[model samples]
Target: MPSAWLSTHLRASRPRVLAALNRAFGDIDVAEDAFQEASLKALKTWQQDDIPKDPAAWLIVAGRNAGIDAFRKKRRETLTAPEDLEPVHDGVHPEEELTLSLDRSVYRDDVLRLLFTCCHPVLRRDQQIALALKIVAGLSVDEIARAFLVQPKTMEQRITRAKKRLQAARLRYEDPDGAERSARFSVVANAIYLVFNEGYSASQGSELIRETLCEEAIRLARLLVRLFPGEPELRGLLALCLIQHSRRRARLSATGQAITLEQQDRLQWDRTLIAEGIILLEAALRKATPGPLQIEAAIAATHTRAARYDETDWAELDRLYRALEIIRPSPVVSLNRAVVIAKLKGPEEALGQLEQLAAPLERYASYHATTAALLTELKQFSKARKAYEAAIQHAGTEVERQHICSKLDALRSRVPGL
Candidate 1:
């Protein structure tokens, strides 16, 4: 089999297989190790023999066996009794047992259980998100580290600490009750959005986006929305992802440079996703219990509703951002509102608004980039050049750095020495 095909299959099967393994073994570390073992085995076996009819099922069975073996080894080393080990099945084959337990609903619940466990309230928010990205989304330690702007070692420690915390908490593998699910819903939603953001603008690498991460985040959001259909914020979260993902095709240039939203080809945007997002947003609005995610989705909806870049209702966007500021104020939100101010009130006013955010967002590349753009519009070439340089210095990814460089070059063309 082709390596790409194998890689894709393994990634797709990871959540289901790992979730099942976690349910069976009742240990995240064991489940993860077992899944890795199973994957390694598949690499050798599938190449020598024909691929299994159900790869995930094969993985689940293999992982269960691996977990049992690991336990047996530990039991022997510790002089533990046989009864303390995994139960031995008589007569029934491993595959048969796995098949009996392979109910789709059970797997779905298992996945949710794994997600909630990773996002347990006992862990800090960063720890929860890092753990979820690693365990549930299957992101690499390095990938999670890049997203968090930390070293791989630091991220690994964070994840380790989170797992230890979870182990201490002894969270149940059973599906959460209504109250429990609702309580954990916000953290889960935030983690999913962070996952989406990481994919939407990957922190590092040649590519500007990681479609796999985006797809995984969307899949998780879809599952969450299904589990909580009455929750407006959940609907809004899914809507936000769909609407943003709709522009994936048009977000990059032929040379792999990031494309500005205004410069993107509207025709390339996915109309189906946009339509669904709008419908979801409308439904959420009817509930009238607006949250940050709902407001963010509304902002995105406002952008998509415009027929062209010029047709965008800047005034409406300004109003929405002001509302967002009142509801969930952050430097990032303020930065976005500044862009709308630039469109409606000119660069001078936008720059004034951004000045207040400098202390809070000095290390944020987008803030510098936005400031540079506003400065350029005002024909303050020297200041714009400085801002662009600052943006490039703070850029998290090679693609982002290159994008800022391209803008800087454009600015230089307008001014001889800039």
Candidate 2:
């Protein structure tokens, strides 16, 4: 198999196979080691022979056997190894038998179990997201660090601490009961969204978006929705991801510059994804649960419903943001609401609202950028230039900096000496 194809397959299979190994062995370290060993073996084996019919099952079996071997080595036990053990049925290969025993529902449950384990209440929110991205999403430590806008060493320590905390907590490896699952669901969903947001607008990189992380997040969201079909929040979460992701194609220019939503070409948007997201949003709204995800999805749906930029229902968006603020009040939500308010009201009123947020969103790049935009609209060129400078100073990525700089350059053109 080609290296690219093989890499993609391995990444896609990683969560399921690792979850299975973790469940079987009851050790995160052992499961990770086993998966690594299996991947190494695959690199050599698949190149020589044809790829396995079910690569995930093959890895699970191989990894399980590898884990047993490692355990035997650690204990120096004379126990019969996995390969030495007799098959459950006559003439049945061990891998074949194990693969047959495992089914789709088992894999889905394993993935969910792993997600919940990573998002255990014992760990902090940042740790939950970082660990899930590492263990379940197969993101490397550096990748996680980049997403968090922290040093790799710092991220490494955080992840190590999280695992140590999990070990100390003695979390159960079995599937969570209904109460436990429900309790942990919110954190799990938040972690997944954090992952998606990191990809949707990467924290720091040459590229504006990270397709792999986005795809992995969508896949995890789909898994969650399937596992809890009646959870309106999960449906809303999936809808939000799909709707936002539909614009990925138009989010960046051919030269890789960041493109604001209003400036993006709607013709490039994926209508299929938009339709699916709308359907999910409508279904979830019918449930009338009214959660944060549903409100955010409603916001995105409202944006997509507009055939043109000027046609967007700014009033409805303002209402949704207010509803979101009541449910999940945060500086970020307030900042976004101010932007919608700028559209429905005026720049002065929006600027007043933004000023109230300055204290809380001092270090946020988008806050500065939005302020600069409002200032520019009001012909406050000097203030806009200063705000744009602040935005550039706090910008996460090269592309983001470039985009803000472009605005600054345009402002300078308007006020030559200023």
Candidate 3:
């Protein structure tokens, strides 16, 4: 009966265990098999007695034992590994290894190390994403398919190809050095952030936001920042996640409608995270390279410092976005900066900025909604009504589509011409 919880624990532990096993034996098949075997042990044992206090640690110890045991039972008893790989059974004792049970950090290192390897430039971007989800995030091939809007078989094939590519490249379970180090680190940062984004806000799921994704992202950001204290960009990324995450509580209304950031309750924001974000951003800015994260954190800091939504410093934000554009110009960032423009000048000025920039976001309802809002501000009711109608066409969620329809109806109410 107690075995019920075992499924949940194993699912969560799979990615971490895979990471640890691959690091220990340098073989994905062995690592995966060991984790599966360890899950069996947990199911058989936990029901008889109390579950281990630190279940992840217990599972890790079990996995190591399982891996070495299988390695010893290999096809050829006299087989020898290369100089880079020592036999798992060579002078290794499980009792001594289990003694380090309290040190759960050791097992966690594999997940982090695997993350670094998967994000290596040698791997294609899709490969990096699939590998990270397959390994670090513990997403099944089916789940990854749903996330990417692809078929399950397609995702399975993608993962298979990525794994083969990773092995062919002989990617090590260690962070690279010098030029490779800096580049590889950025990929790792991006992968972790993407995982968190998926969890924080589900792209394909019915829910507006997924708390698990958000928590995982924040956790990874914290881990990376701790591991690479000297790297300012890492710290900047952590700060950005922290600040954005602080507003999670107020993102959805009581009826589960997605609330705009300005409408979100400022008091509900996580003050601790905001303060930490500010501290991290300040530290990260010391390095001369003004990166995208630094700019994002700067913007988040401004929001965190504001007494109320109306009190947000638009001029400072405009200048910061300008700096951000120089570093990494993005349509999304430009759209965000337009909100400040609407506040400082007028909707017409903001509309001008939006028009000049090509928004590849036309297919997205949010893009249409934003245009409609600006048009409404300009008193161009007919145009606003038309944009809102278009917005409803692309709206992904029912709640968003309802809001767009309401906007369209409001315009129609004022003018029969609409």
Best model number under TM-score: 2
The residue-by-residue lDDT of candidate 2 on 308-345, one tens digit each, is 89999999999999999999999999999999999988
How big is the positional error of residue 20 in model 3, measured in Å on the Cα after superposition?
A: 4.4
Off by over 4 Å in 2: 2-10, 37-58, 77-107, 121-130, 139-161, 173-179
Rank list by TM-score: 2, 3, 1
lDDT of 1 by residue, 323-368 (tens): 9999889999999999999999899999999999999999999999
What TM-score goes with each of the models?
0.76, 0.83, 0.79
lDDT of 3 by residue, 1-418 (tens): 5566777777766666677777877877677788878878878777535666556656667787787668767834686444534433312223344446535556545655677766656777777777776666666777667766678899888877877877888865444456776776677888766766665552355343256556666766776777667778788889988898898878777766667677888889999989999999998888877777778889889888888888888999999988887788878778877877888899988898888654577787877788888998788887887788888999886767876787788778877866
- Backbone clashes in candidate 3 total 3
Candidate with the larger lDDT of 1 and 3: 1
TM-score of model 2 vs. true structure:
0.83
Candidate scoring better on TM-score of 1 and 2: 2
**Per-residue lDDT of 125 in model 2:** 80
The models' CA-based lDDT, in order, is 0.83, 0.85, 0.73
